[model samples]
Target: MGGQVPSKLTEKFDPHRLVMRGTQAYQPRCIALEGSVGVTTRCSIHPQRPSICREVLPSWESGEPYPQCDKARIAHGLSPLAPEDWIRFKDANASAA
Candidate 1:
């Protein structure tokens, strides 16, 4: 679930719904989210998270910008992610492996 690239066949963990849970009324968050929403966060079920979760971010891996990703980060008082962030993450993950 935590991999940068999930396989086509197993990319989605949707049973037709999202596990939305909001700590604040202003925004809806995922129940599987861990750590802080804006400052630092990771999915508790990264491997099994829904496809929407994986693709909703500014998908530099796919060469697409999803406004929703930056919007959510801004709402949470976090800076938007750049492609370099993704690159760093990918590199770190590769090193970890």
Candidate 2:
């Protein structure tokens, strides 16, 4: 199990547990990328993704965007969504509703 893991990540990782839990873990080894993420954020296996993936909401409490979304955007060199962004999102949804 440990044989496939990257040298850097192997130090703290328990490959046996990873294999046992599979996709149930927060950050599964199966979906982990060896290198940096590309420009696109699309999931290749979205169609067959686990229930956990389907359950994750883009935002929390309807109007407020999730902080993790901003963190990922920042990691990809994009600006974090501001408070005004949430206001606009809520306004757009309210009109649609």
Candidate 3:
């Protein structure tokens, strides 16, 4: 078996460069994405989510600003997460070095 990893680029990818399902493509909310957009949200089929859902991680999770997170938030009239939004998760001694 070839032990080579597949390239991330190919046709059937969006401008954000994510592979989207036919119905979810260009649609703000995905069939897999459940719950309210602004108030609360969760992936119903997280274990079997599409490539787009897997690729587009939350900003705090990847430690980089993910525009999809912000876009979704704004679309539902919710503010984008602030840099300090994840402060609660910080270690107590992280800044005491």
Every candidate's CA RMSD = 7.6, 9.5, 8.1
**Worst lDDT 10-window in candidate 3:** 1-10
- Predictions ranked by lDDT, top down? 1, 3, 2
Q: What lDDT does the true structure give each of the candidates?
A: 0.63, 0.52, 0.58
> Which segments of model 2 are wrong by more than 4 Å?
1-13, 19-40, 50-56, 82-97
Cα lDDT tens digits for candidate 1, 7-91: 3323233775333344233556655678985557887767676656766756365566678987876877877777888889889
Give stretches of model 3 more than 4 Å off.
1-28, 89-97
lDDT of 2 by residue, 1-97 (tens): 1234433322323644322223345644434333444443455445544444455555544667777776766766677667676778789999999
| Best candidate according to TM-score | 1
Candidate 3 per-residue C-alpha lDDT over 36-84 given as tens digits, one digit per residue, 9 for 90 to 100: 7666778665665655456766766546788998886787788877667
Error of 3 at 88 (Å): 3.1
Top-scoring candidate (lDDT)? 1
Residue-level lDDT for 93 in candidate 1? 100
For each candidate in turn, the TM-score is 0.55, 0.37, 0.55
> Per-residue error at 49 for model 1, in Å?
4.9
Q: Give me the runs in candidate 1 sitting further than 4 Å from their true place.
A: 1-19, 23-28, 45-55
